[model samples]
Target chain A: DQQVKQNSPSLSVQEGRISILNCDYTNSMFDYFLWYKKYPAEGPTFLISISSIKDKNEDGRFTVFLNKSAKHLSLHIVPSQPGDSAVYFCAASRYNAGNNRKLIWGLGTSLAVNP
Target chain B: GAGVSQSPSNKVTEKGKDVELRCDPISGHTALYWYRQSLGQGLEFLIYFQGNSAPDKSGLPSDRFSAERTGGSVSTLTIQRTQQEDSAVYLCASRPPGGGTDEQFFGPGTRLTVL
Candidate 1:
């Protein structure tokens, strides 16, 4: 069974609009959540992260909201630019028996911004 | 290097052939991880290394997959007797040692095509 899931395979938004991507997880042990962006032929880059203790975290035009009770999280990009087009992956991290943290990843949502 | 890098950006191998993918993490990073993404699938964890401890290879799919981190820096993932189902993009990520969140830096990845 998938611990983390991104049900939407793709999302499209016009430049200057708001784009929202959603993710869900089944593991209650997950305490840290992160988002990564990837362009074609390039490695994924860290975008933003939120701890389970907080309900929301924001960086400039990007904001991540977590609803712990619902087991859901969403990433919002305001004034979306064409440059924001890429695959967005949501990952959750939890420490295992060895005291080391490992990430559980979602399938990723492909976002396209139209200029 | 400034970022994690993987060698042989792309590889094509015949079924039953063995292939090795290498990763060079940023200097001083003590944690390394291997993951793969098959078409339309999420990133699957294969293995992880931290400092001088034995690697966490619980996520490896089968005996055919193996990885080693030497000197606690560079890592190599080897797939033995590759099969067509083994085709995927292998990614390497590194995490800096600190108290910050569990964000990881990734390499461009090696796209493997098995025929």
Candidate 2:
């Protein structure tokens, strides 16, 4: 079963506009959430993360908000750039579970930011 | 050389053949992870290794799949008598000494095609 899900298969946004990507999870035990960006033929690179204790986390133009009650989380990019065009994957994990903290990923969403 | 490195970026083999994929984690990183991604699918966790401790192989699909981390630095994933269903891009990631909270850096991945 897929523990994390990204409903949107693809998204297109204009440059300098805000881009929003959403994710949902089924497991309540997951206390940590992360977003990763990947390019063709390249490994995914870490983008941003949020802890369960906090509802939001921001890094520069990227912000991630989590709603525990709804089991939903989203990543927002302000003034999206063409460089932001890539596939984004949402991952989750629970700490203190030994090596079980390994990440569970979502089917990625391909974001194309048109210039 | 600075980030995680994987060998044989692409591999094409006939059915019933065995293949070995290799990964070299970042220097001094104590945690290593393996994942598989099929076309248009999410990342699937396969195994995890931390220091000299026993690996978490719960995500492995069958007995034909196995992995080992030697000298706590390099890892190898073996798929015996491969099948077409086994074709996918295998990814490896590594985390530093800070444990699960640390962000993981991934390698470019090895794409395997079984025909």
Give DockQ for candidates 1 onward, in order.
0.89, 0.77
Per residue, candidate 2 scores C-alpha lDDT tens digits across B1-115 of 6999998899999999999999999999999999999998878889999888899999899999999999999999999999999999999999988655758899999999999
lDDT of 2 by residue, A1-115 (tens): 8889999999999999999999999999999999999998999999999999899999999999999999999999998999999999999988755654678899999999999
- Name the regions of candidate 2 deviating beyond 4 angstroms: none
Q: Please give me the total number of clashing residue pairs in predicted model 1.
A: 0
What overall lDDT goes with each candidate model?
0.94, 0.94
Q: After superposition, how far is residue A41 of candidate 1 from its true place, in Å?
A: 1.0
TM-score of chain B of 2: 0.96
Candidate 1 residues lying further than 4 Å off, grouped into runs, are: none
Highest TM-score against the true fold, candidate: 1
- Supply candidate 1's per-residue lDDT for B49: 95
Best by DockQ: 1
